[model samples]
Target: MDFDEYVAARGQALERFAYVLTGDAHRAQDLTQTALLKAYRHWRRVTAAEHPDAYVRRIVTRSYVDWRRRGSSREEPVDVVPDLPEEGASADPAERVAARDELRRALVTLSPKQRAVLVLRDYEGYDDAAIAATLDCAEASVRSHASRGLARLRAVLSEPTVPEELR
Candidate 1:
């Protein structure tokens, strides 16, 4: 497919990927825009690749990692969650949102590269080799990141709901 068509088809997904990486809607949009602009310059090369989406996703992932390394995009995580709409007075939706938020919060504790590795491997179901290629790292590094990331996430998520200070 052509560049325009590719963007049309994958734009939202790409933005969502960035959102997962950055945890901020505005930053996600910026990251997606940057990746797409870069891809547009080499549209022919990108589209000619066997998995063009993966190619563009690599752009987004690498940009995110690089941005994190540079300590740019100083967006802070939101401390307050907006009220969710009540679904027929059921609390299930709220619970799910809480879980998702908890996971997002837990994810932020990971280093950017580790977060990228986990998101690509677990969230996106990419294999280690693919993640290595996407992150421009070795497969062993991918495995190390994924292992440490998961461990960190578990530790963060398993903490008591009541803060130790509260306790």
Candidate 2:
């Protein structure tokens, strides 16, 4: 596909990948924008690759991993806090939403490399060698990151959520 067509088709997916990698929508948007800009500038080389989607995903993943080295801020700027769930909200769907939110929070606690590794492995279904290639790291590093990241997520997710009354 041409550059514009690629962007038009895969743009939302790219943004979602960035969001999962960064755990912040705003940063994800910035990350996607930056990666796509680079990809556009190198369109020929990217499209010439065996798997152009993986190529662009690598750019997004690597960019997220490298953001720390560039000394970017840890916290995002927000205008206001989000509202709590309504009292009458049903339990089943609310529980699912809460579970997803908890998972997202747990993900953000991992180091950038670990987070990227887990997302690519568990979320995106990439194999070890593919993850290594995308992250430009060793296979051993990918395994290490994945193991440590899973352990961390387990620890975080296992913690008890304090009741509103207790808080």
Candidate 3:
């Protein structure tokens, strides 16, 4: 397919992949746009690849890693805290949001490579070989990153949260 067609079919998926990789919607958009621009510059070559989507995804992943390496992605803390759940709100949705927020927090604690490996392996359902190709790393390195990433997440999430009474 041509560049426009490829984007039309895959843009949202690419953006979602980037979001999972970066854990930020705005950064995901920037990463997706950067990758698409690169792909557009060499559309013929990209479309000729065996799996063009994978090619674009590799670009997004690399762009995120490069951006992080340059130290432009550091997050500064905000003085204002988020609103707590409403007193009468149902517990299930609030619990899910809390869990998701905790996961995002845990993800940010990981190194970029570890985050990428975890997202590509677990979130994207890619096998070791595909993750290796996407990250341009050895399969063993991919396995190592995934293991360490998961272990970190477990350590962070499994930490006990003090109850309101305790606090």
Question: How good is model 2 by TM-score?
Answer: 0.81
Error of 1 at 159 (Å): 3.2
- Among all windows of ten consecutive residues in candidate 2, which has the lowest summed lDDT? 76-85
Per-residue C-alpha lDDT of model 1 across residues 59-119, encoded as one tens digit per residue: 9999999989987655654343333234553457777777667777666678899999988
**lDDT of each residue in 31-145, candidate 2, tens digit only:** 9999999999999999999999999999999999899558774554322223333455536796668766656656656788888888999889999999999988899999999
Q: Which stretches of model 3 miss by more than 4 angstroms?
A: 74-97, 162-167
lDDT accuracy of residue 104 in candidate 3: 68
* Cα lDDT listed for each candidate: 0.83, 0.82, 0.82
- 2 against 3, candidate with superior TM-score: 3
Query: TM-score for all predictions?
Result: 0.82, 0.81, 0.82
Better-scoring candidate (lDDT), 1 or 2: 1
Candidate 3: 10-residue stretch with minimal lDDT: 76-85
Q: Candidate 1 — which pairs collide?
A: none
Residue by residue across 52-71, what tens digits does model 3's lDDT show?
99999989989988888888
Best by lDDT: 1
